[model samples]
Target: MPIRYALPNDADAMAEITCAAFAEFEDFDVTREQSAANWRRNLLAEAAERPRPHHTRIAELPDGTVIGLVKGGPADPGLGLDAEILALAIHPDHQRHGHGRALLRTVAADLCADGFGSLAIRVLAVNERARRFYTSLGGVLAGEVPPGEVFYAWPELAALL
Candidate 1:
């Protein structure tokens, strides 16, 4: 899988992957149209952010089919992290193929190069597979948010690379 910076035109594909990925979670709820609109709005806002404080990357196969995406940005310093992964998703059809790992590593590398040392991500507490994945990648359980979300952190971003 090849990972690259996400473009505005990729929003629909990103939305598709996101919707498909999250649909597997019984508690997750969002329509594809809603997801697409959100991605479009966010991508536009990201384009206007001077110096690009955030990062979004897409994973695709040689045939140009998008399979996964990762979006991240500056985190609340209170979380003991300099950067945070806001979203990470791989299409249900593509899960367990390492596309998620590739996308994550790519974003971590970018953040590390940009001087972000530590990273964190919040996952739905019910997403056991995701929790295990983060743990396998060296993320430590840091804390939790009410109503069912947990934070995982990596003190060294380079460790992901």
Candidate 2:
């Protein structure tokens, strides 16, 4: 897959990827409540923003489809991690390959080089698969912040990198 910055035209695909990636969590959960409708609204709002979040990226396939994507930002009511992995997904048909890892590494390096010393990301503690993948990528749970917490400490961008 070829990775690149996402363009405005990618919005629909981005929303779709976001939805599919988080399909399991689209319903209300113990830690948080989210719906597909709410997700679509948020995605559209972000897409329409004049000054948009800079961390979202896409992975394009040989066939020209956007098969994967990764996005990051700081957690709200911020703890100052400077960065957070908002969402990362490889289409169900494209998973089990290294696209996710490559996308993450690129995002991390970009954030780190951009003067962020640390980064934080919150994965639902219940998503054991994601939690494990993150841990393997050199991330540790600084602790649980609850209610969709980005797991890390202050200067989190520094600490995480």
Candidate 3:
């Protein structure tokens, strides 16, 4: 898989991957329309931000089929994290093939190069598979929010590289 910075043109494929990936989770509530709209809005916002507070990357095959995406940015100081992975999704058909890992690593490297020392990501508490994946990658349980969300953190972002 080749990972590259996401462009505005990649929004549609990113949204489709996001919708298909989330659709597999019964606890995730999102409509296709909402997902599409949200991706567009997010991409636009990212584009408009000066100095780009966040980075979005896409993972695709050599033939140009997009399969995964990851968006990350500086985290709120209150979260005790220097940066946070805002979103990560791989098309269901592409799961378990390392696309997700590659996407995450690519973004993590970008953040690390930008001087962020630690990273965190929040996932639905009901998502055991995701929790396991994060833990396997050296993310430790960091915190939780009410109504079913948990945070995973890598205190040393360089460890991921």
RMSD of each: 1.8, 4.6, 1.9
Q: Return the top candidate by lDDT.
A: 1
Candidate 1: regions farther than 4 A off: 1-8
Please provide, for model 3 over 1-161, each residue's C-alpha lDDT reduced to its tens digit, 9 standing for 90 to 100: 45444443566787788888888678778777777788889888988998787888887777778888899999867679999999999888888887778778889998988889999999999888899999989999999966688999999998788
- The lDDT values for all models are 0.86, 0.63, 0.84
TM-score of 3: 0.90
Cα error, residue 114 of model 3, in Å, equals 1.7
State in Å the error of residue 119, model 3.
Answer: 0.3
Give the top-scoring candidate (TM-score): 1
Give one digit per residue, the lDDT tens place, for model 1 in 1-161: 45444443577888899988898777778888889998998899888998788888887776778888898889977787899999999988888978888889988887887789999999999999999999999999999977689999999989999
**Which of candidates 2 and 3 is the stronger one according to lDDT?**
3
Clashing pairs for predicted structure model 1, backbone only: none
User: What pairs collide in candidate 2?
Assistant: 117-157, 117-158, 118-156, 118-157, 118-158, 118-159, 119-156, 119-157
